[model samples]
Target: AREVGMPLKMARAVQVGGPAWHWANFAKVARNFEWEKKVGNSVVVREAVGVVGCITPWNFPLSQITLKIAPAMAAGCTVVLKPSEIAPVNAMILAEIIHDAGVPAGVFNLVNGTGPVVGEVLGTHPQVDMVSFTGSTGAGKRVSELASQSVKRVTLELGGKSASVILDDANFEAAVKGTVSACMLNSGQTCSAHTRMLVPASRYEEVRALAQAAVARFSIGPSLDEASKLGPLVSAAQRDRVLNFIRIGIAEGADVIAGGPDTPATGKGYFVQPTVLGIKASDTLAQEEIFGPVLVVIPYRDEEDAVTIANNTIYGLGGAVWSASDEHAVKVARRIRTGQIDINGGPFNGSAPFGGYKQSGNGRENGIYGFEEFLEFKAMQFKPSAG
Candidate 1:
């Protein structure tokens, strides 16, 4: 709560959004399912044994935690939550909220420790029926492997190296600003952030200028600052990781058109300015997910090249396509290999399914799609007796 400067009430609201939203939508789904149910000759469905192990990440700490916790509880499953050790304070607050919400004791449990110690234990625990993890692909793979030993179901939301394609016919100003803002959001810590921008060669210089201006305008300061648009990376290690990418970008001969490899001496905390890199499609900067306020601008010859460059990444999480005409933008978006594609300046709706293809990991989260992750389906058939 203190880290983001959110009030106790607002923090609670944010943490509880997942559960509240899930149940609200779940009720609608349940009602609809009931309407479809015929009262005769159907095998009765019975509730099974229920227990869930939820492992959440540091970014969007409370939100992710609640997403798993709330749905599990709503589905009649007891939960044991192991929040990221990097942001334990927020998790502690969440535990308090769960306790105050009058939830049962064994229904909700919060354990605080690093991934190796606590996370590993939870994943391998025989008592945990399922494991829900949100983190890097590497860690998620380990979680899946360990949980598989017990034949426990696993749901993972992992990393992304998303792309943003700005069509030749798109408004350069709007496209540039949108891409920059997307990368700057949450200091670019978001898994689905459009960090790689593909712009047409004709408007390359123009787009670069607009991106530089957008980066320059970003306010990087203490997390508590109301006016600060870009806060520090989650920790010192995260800050270093982002800085290393910046270093690699410079070393790989990409143009650092805007912010570069320097932390402000005035600030004692972990902070990095929003950086914009003008690079070729082949550059390393264009291929990696910095997960910071870092943007890679790659110029493409045409629509085909743009799509090629965008899909070159192993990650296919989320992306955006901008064009003068909605029809044109949708055409480009359809070709890109991503789970979610935004047209124009479309807002991110939590109601939609969020996940990825390829190495970005499997399965979806959010909306009815996410809820189905907990469900198991079976079809039964019977033949009428011949008398």
Candidate 2:
């Protein structure tokens, strides 16, 4: 409760005048399952029908688990949670919290294991009615295929290769700094991080210098430190994956304009310095999802070219646009194929729908959008006075 409250307060402080920025708001709405029926005229019509399979990732462990569990409980559905083994400790803590919260036995269960073993089992299990997965596009595909045999409803929030387009008219310093920070947040593990930066060729050198300096100034260290702007990759395997992408960026001829390789002399945990790569529009790094502290900076001739380069990737989960004029930025943002686009460093609203396009996956989460995922719609008509 305290941690949730803190996030709410922080969001309110940052967003100001936004939606009811309180944890109580979430709890309150979560308690009201009838609201869905009232609005959509849809109901489960069957109580404790079957089990819900929740396969969550390591990032944002508690929140993701809660996102699945809370609604399932409200709908009177039992759940079998398979949280990522890399972050299983938090799952244990969450299971304790749910148990202490007085949720009934057999209503919520936790299974700790890898994706291939536990996740596949849960997805393919005949008794499970639905599966909610949050992971990579590759994993999401497999989960969907497995669930299809049972004809179970599936919801997925998968990988993203987001782009941040800096228009020629935008403030070069602010745009570069914001894009760099977005790329470095969560050590760039966030599915919606703006990893591909599109800049006008006229301001390419100027933006590159600013972004390079910004990446150099990021503080990478342990998660417990409040001052640490970045944390180590979740595990050694993730660290290696990120490092391999960095190597690929170099091999593909993307200029290492900023931080690269591992942090020097940091022996305790897995750490990679924030890296920035300047590549041509056609480079492989410019079109791939490097889910690390690696930014691919591509130069474009104009707004049209910038939009083209930004939308050239297979993933279209999220993006950003920066320009001197809000109207111009909005116009450019509309051209991108991403599900969500931020203009001028605007805040992210949890109440809005969040998902992706293309290989980034389908469907949405959060607000009324997320609530409808578990629902089945049926329309009925009655002929009056026919008798």
Candidate 3:
């Protein structure tokens, strides 16, 4: 819990509802699937991939584990899960729950250790049929490489440096405020957070001012504080990492519009100020994932320029577009190369396929698409019956 800074409400919702949602999705998909189907004179069948390795991240620990475990089990595949060592408490509770619920022995195994040890073993084990991972892009590449040796199917949910494009006609106040919240969510550690806010060059000053004001209003306190709008990062190392990025941004000629690399006076937890930087689209600050409560504002000349700036990153996990007209926002969203785009602050659909394109990693998760990751297909030839 100290690692991810998950608020009570967020943690409770995931603990209470995440499993139900996963199970319901699995049941619904299982019922709808054609278990045995005929194609001409042949039969096509779907079967469970034998063993699945579920490597979950510290952020949203319980839900990430459940999302991978539930679907794999529902598809009749046994699992070996490696929860992040930084926050393994909740996963332990989950394991107890599984035992209490009477899941078959050896069906679900839990291993506690560092990623380099336990995680690497799972990735390279010949007995493991598939591996599903969520973490940094560099680590995901390592996992993919290890799993490749075993010829195991691998699915990765990696890092992102997503952009939020505020069209020239968008509501400046709403877009700026919304983008700030999106960037600051989970203390800006969320992989899909829209850390780069792209605004029209004509309104860059206006948007930057509004964003600074909005960020100024955010309350920073302990994660458990009822009034805290922002919390400390996962660890001291993470705190230093983010601070280094902020320092790098300033060194690269970007202006710190709000917040800075200054450490909070608390001197206990790993806290960082909510920082915003005014930078060019090509600046290092605009292209990299800080993975903290640090946002970069970029100016675009036109709609085409906005799309170009948004798609310039190697990571394309998530993004958003805002405009008065839904059609216009979607037009701009479609031009951006990302796995998912939120138009005008659309509500998140839990059932939608979630993953990414480019270096953001491969394969899909959530809904029916995620469940199918633990399955394989077979076709059998048969003679046609004659009357």
Give the best candidate by TM-score.
3
Instruction: Tell me the tens digit of each residue's lDDT in model 3 across 86-133.
Output: 989888988998999999999999999999999999999989999999
- Deviation of model 2 at 104, angstroms: 1.1
Clashes of each: 0, 0, 0
> What is the Å distance of residue 50 in model 1 from its true position?
2.7
> Residue 230: error of model 3 in Å?
0.9
158: Cα error in model 3, Å: 0.6
Give the Å error, residue 359, model 1: 1.7
Q: List per-prediction Cα lDDT, in the order shown.
A: 0.79, 0.77, 0.87
Which pairs clash inside model 3? none
Tens-place lDDT per residue, model 1, 245-325, is 999988989888898889865375778878998888888888777888899989889889989999998889999999999
Model 2: which residue pairs collide?
A: none
Better of 1 and 2 by TM-score: 1
Q: Estimated TM-score per prediction?
A: 0.91, 0.88, 0.96
Q: Per TM-score, what order, best first?
A: 3, 1, 2
